[model samples]
Structures are given as structure tokens and as C-alpha cells.
Target: MNQNQSFRQLWISQSIANLGDSFYILAIVTFIYNRTGSAAFAGLFPILRVCAQAISGLAAPLLMDRLRLGTLLWMAEMGQTICFGSMCILYFFLPSQWLIPAVLFLVFAISMLHGWAIPVRNALVPRLVPSHLLVKANSLLATSDQIVLLVGWSLGGILVAEWGVIRVLEITAIMMFFSTLALLFVKDPSANVSAQPESQKRWDRMKEGWITIWGNPILRTLSYMEIISGLGESIWAGSIILVFVKEVLHKGEDWWGFINASNFAGTILGGLLIWKLSKKIENRMLFTMLISSFSIGVLTIAFTYSSNPWFALGVALIMGPPYQARSIAQRTLLQFHTPEVLLPKVFAAFGTILFVTFGFSVLLMGWMADQWGIRFVYMSTAGLYVLSAFLTLMMMKKASRSIQTQKEERYMNKIE
Candidate 1:
């Protein structure tokens, strides 16, 4: 098939997967909340699921070769189907806590599949489209994903409330199954690897990935960067609903609709703008710092005491556009620096790193908010973002040197 054809297929597949995710998030959160009737308890469900995902993320990249990308994704769809089924079918007979572990396991399994898919999926796109078009493609993906986020969250719970949690789960599963059909036409690119016998031990395979990042200061730096970003992100996540519904502004459950759609708008716009602006820029790292600082710093103030419902929603819409711009810069750096096959393992490592760092912060932020004033929590979070920005500068310095070294090596190879 032609390059455009290839890209269109991949893009559609990604959109399908994202739409399913939107529905899945809607179904799971709404179902849990209805079953339990407590916000804290509803939140607990995702926490367990995230924990499971975090654990599986560590091993997922190592196991990527267990199947081709097409097959891996197909199996993921199957897992989603089973996961949804377990939720609805088991709910009829199972106890509350039982659903907790079962759904947790299913989500974790889904995450593991995601771990395998992300790097390969990311790596595949550049081959399908020209380099110049990649930013645009990514932006498109980011935008749609967020748009769907708004829709899914708004309707997902209402469906559960009126129909049943089991019905919601079942519908999401069907959505997932339909999404999988989109993958059938996806062009399987060459697996990003050099053919070698399967002799490496799993521990050692994982270790080599670690050692590669550790040995390369730039990759090591990105690792830490991902951790910090993920952590600060978790704070906003864990607190947003509570802060919005109770502390900052109250719109009842409709608050979720506003928050999700607006935040998604920010992300979508960010992605779109990045696509446009990336070619004009050279010092992406510095530009990234400036834009991301705006995002993180703004959150600090926005959550300081809580504002009007409309005001917060407006803030998100304003913020969404820059989200992808900042995100794309980071992704470009990672993609440029790494080769193809190793991308999965590196990303898996990144996921593991993300979960541990962010997971700890989620627990920490939740506890702190419980004990201290939410206003104080906002101030503390602002400080965290500033600290992270400073650390990025430090990491960037070392990364710059590595880039120079790589250029020198490339230049010397030309002479040879």
C-alpha cells in the first residue's frame, strides 16, 4: 500500500483504540461509583488498576516479541472483552470487593498489552508518513482522543445510572471489539530488531535495557523527566474531581463533563499547535520548558482555592492546545535518540518508572489533601512543578553534551 494509505490506516486504528479507551474509562469509573456510592471508594478502583498496570508495565516490553504487533493488539482487544464481561457477568453474583480484584487484574492486563503496543505503535508511524507530517498526525491523534474523553465521561455514568453498571461494561466491551476490527487493515511494518536467536534471559534482557538508559546519560535524563512529570500529573488527577465538585466549584456530576472536555481540549489543541510550530523551532528543549512551565504553574494557581465552574473549564480549554506541543517535543527527543526495536523496552521501563514515581505521588497527594487544606496542597504542588522545571534544566545540560558526542561520532563515521 501507499504511504498515505498506511498512515491513514494507523491513524484510524489509533483513533479507534482511543475511542474505546474513552468508553472504557467512562464505563469503569461510572460503574464503580454506582456500585459503591462513595467517591473515595470509586477512586480506589483505578488506583488498584494503575498499580496492576505499573507492575505489568515492567515486564511488558520484555515480552513484546511474544507476538507480532498486530497479534499483540488483537489479544489486547480480547482481554478488554473478557474484562468487560467479568465486570458485568460477575457482578450479578460476586461481592463488591471481588469486582475490585477482578477488574483490577483485567485493567492490569490491558495495561500490559498497552505497554507492548505504545513504543512499537509510535515507532511505526514515522515510517508510514513523512517526517514533516508526523507532528500533524500526532496532533490529530491527541486532539480526537481528548474530544472523545469529554463525550465518553459525560455519557458513561448516565448510562450506568439509568441502565446498569453491567450494561455499561458490556457496551464498552462491544465498543472495544469493534475497535479491534479497525486494526485488521493495519500494515505490519518490519519489527524494529536485528535478527538474533532468542537466547537472552528475561532478567538480563530487561537489565540491558536499563543499562542502555543508564549508560546513556540523555536517556537516563529522560527517564527522570518522565518520572517527575508523571508525579505532578497524578496530583492534578487525584484531586481534580474533589477540588472541582466540593472545594473549587460545584456542578454536581456535570463537573466531570466540564473537567474532562476542557482538559481534553487543551491536550488536543496543544497537539495541533505543536504540529504546526515544530518545524519553525530548533531549541525544542528550552521551548518545551517554557510551555510546560506555563501549564504546570497555571495549575498551581488554578487550584489554589477553586474558582468558578466556568472559569476552570475555560482554563482547561485555554490550556489544552499547549499540552501536545510540550508533549510532542519530549516524544521527538525520545524517538530521535532511540533506535526502533529497543523502543518498546525503553518505553516499558519508562512506564515502570512512571507508575512508581506517579503512584507514590498519587498516594502522597491524596493523604496530604486528607490531612491539610486543599489550598495548601495547591501551593505545594506549584512548588513541585517549579522544582521539576529546574531539574529538567540540569538534565538538559548533560543531554546536550551527549548530543554533541553523538554528532561527533556520526561525523567521524562519515570520514571513515
Candidate 2:
């Protein structure tokens, strides 16, 4: 297959995998809570997933360097297929009391593999398309991802409630297996391998991504913002959102599906808008960061106070564009700035930060939900976004100054 056609195939495969991920997450969280009747218990699953992701992210760059990108993609998909397929079988045969532990173990395993899969997928995109088309490509892929998410989030709850979680998981496994087949037609891209000390310490090698981020001012600021934003974004933990729907909004499983689907519908719209306006978006990074933080703050506050489910859905729809724009911009910026040799490590570090911060935030928010109410937790997340907005504005100024200085330095070097 040609490069463009291969990318399209990869995108479709990943979209299917994304749908499976969404389905399994909603199904598993609801399953846990339905059985245990504890939001805290359900919360543990997200923590488990993120914690495994964080650990795996630390090693993702190493794996990416050692293995073919296509191999990583196929391996991750096949691994998850096995994990989910095993869960489906075991759930039926295992003792009732063993279900939770068994599910948790598989979730952790799937998540660990996922940690490797996502960064590899992201890093592979730039290789698939030329620099000029990167923005459009990212936008289209993001939209596809969101569309699948929209379907998965919307249908997952209803399916779980109607057909049962085990059945949903079985279907998810089948989808994952199908996704793995697509990679067989695509050729793996060569890595931009960099030289390293022959005797470099393992710890130093492990810290390569972190060290790179620390050395780059823009990456440093963006990485910090990601961590803080993650804290605010913790409200998206499945159990917490489910609790909000059930306890605060007094809704059912369908409502949970509706709310999440509404959020993802907004994401798809936002991706389309960004794709159309790619040339018009001057200073993409600053605009995305500022708008993202501001919109998130506004939506969080609006959703927090809204008593009606429809009103909450309306707010969710409005939040979509800024969220999509910010993600697209951040990704574009990373690809534009970081060299290919270092990009995997940089992305690995960024993912690790997000996973670690997001994981703990979910656990902490889960406890707070029990103590202070889900509404309070939602409002608190809004406060975090506000802080993120303020910080991002400050960083924008810093980035502009850095860009100007670098331009002058390059001009002087040319003259010399």
C-alpha cells in the first residue's frame, strides 16, 4: 500500500481500538460499581490503569527504540485482545468473589500495554505524512478517534445495562482482534536513532525523556500545564461521572451514556472546526492553551450548577471545540519543535506525567466525592482549570520571547 493509504488504514484500525477501549472502560467501571456498590471501589480501576500506564510510559521510549512501530501497534492490539478475551471467559467461569480481582489484573495488564501503544501511535503519525499536512492529518485522526469515542461512550452504558458487562467485554475483545489485522498491510517506519554513551547508566537512560523536557523551556512549561490540566480533567473518571449522573442528576445508565456521548460529539465538532481553520489559526499554541483552559473553566462551573441533565449536556457540547483545538495545537507544536530522534522520548515523558497526575487525581477525587459530594469535586476541578489558564497565559509570553530571541540568533548566525 501507498503511504497515504497505509496511514488511512492505520487510522481506521486505531479508531476501532479506541472504540473498544471506551466500551471496556465504561463496561468495567459500571460492572465493578454494580457489583460492589462502592464508588471508591470503581475508582480503583482508573487508578490501576493509569498507574500501570505511568510505569509503562517510563519504558515506552526504550521499547520504541528497540522494536518496530508496527510491531508495537500489533503487539498492543493482540495483547489487549488476549487480555479481554481471557476476561470474558474467566468472568463466566471464575467464582463470583474472584471476578473483581481478575478484572483488575487484566485491566492493569491491558493498560500497561496501552501505555506503550499510545505514544508509539502518536509518534508514528509524523512519519506517515509530510510536515505541511500534519495539522490536517492530526485533525482528521482526532475527529475519527472522537467519533468512535462518541459511539462507544453513548452505547457502552446502555449495552452494559441491557446485554450485561461480560457480553460487552466479549465484543470489545473481538473488535481489538480485528484492529490488529490492519497493521499487517502497513510497513514499519525506520527509527531516527540517536547516539548514546556506551556505558550510560540505566537510570540516566530512563531519565532521557525527563531530561529533554527539563532542558527545553517550552516543553517544560507545556509539560507542567499538562500535569495541572490533568488534575482538573480528573472529573472524567468513569465512576465519578457515573455517580454524578446517578446521585446528582438522578439519572439512569442511559443518561450516563448520553452525557459522555454529548461530550464526545462536541469533540468531533471541534476537530472539524480546527481542521477547516488550520490556516486561519495564527499562533496556534497560545490560542489553543488559552481557549482550552478558559473553556474548561466555564464548562466546569456551568455543569456543576446545572440541575437538569439537558442543561449539562448543552454545556458539554459547548466545551468540545476548545478541548479539541487545544489537543490538536499541543500535538502540532510538539511535532514541529522536537526532532524525530528525541520525539518519542519527549512524548513518553509527557505521557508519564499525565498518567501519574491523572491517576492520583482520580483516586483523590474519588475519596472527595464520597466526602464533599460530586458537585463539590466538579467545582474544585474548575478551580484547577482557572489556575491552569493563568499559568498558560504567563507561559505564552515566555514562549513568544523565546521565539523572537531564537529568530534573531539565527539571523546573526547567517550574517556571520
Model 1 weakest lDDT span, ten residues long: 188-197
Question: Superposing every Cα of model 2 onto the true structure, what RMSD results?
Answer: 3.3
Q: How high is the lDDT of residue 275 in model 2?
A: 87
Error of 2 at 267 (Å): 1.4
TM-score per candidate, chains pooled:
0.83, 0.86
Q: Which lDDT values do the candidates have, in the order given?
A: 0.66, 0.83
Tens digits of lDDT, candidate 1, 262-381: 677678677666666756643565557555755676765775655677777777667565455656666666666776666656666777777778778877777777788566666776
Off by over 4 Å in 1: 1-3, 30-41, 85-108, 192-197, 238-241, 248-260, 281-286, 302-312, 394-416
lDDT of 2 by residue, 256-320 (tens): 86787788889999999988887766356676778788888888999998889999889888888
For candidate 2, give the lDDT. Answer: 0.83
The count of backbone overlaps in candidate 2 is 0
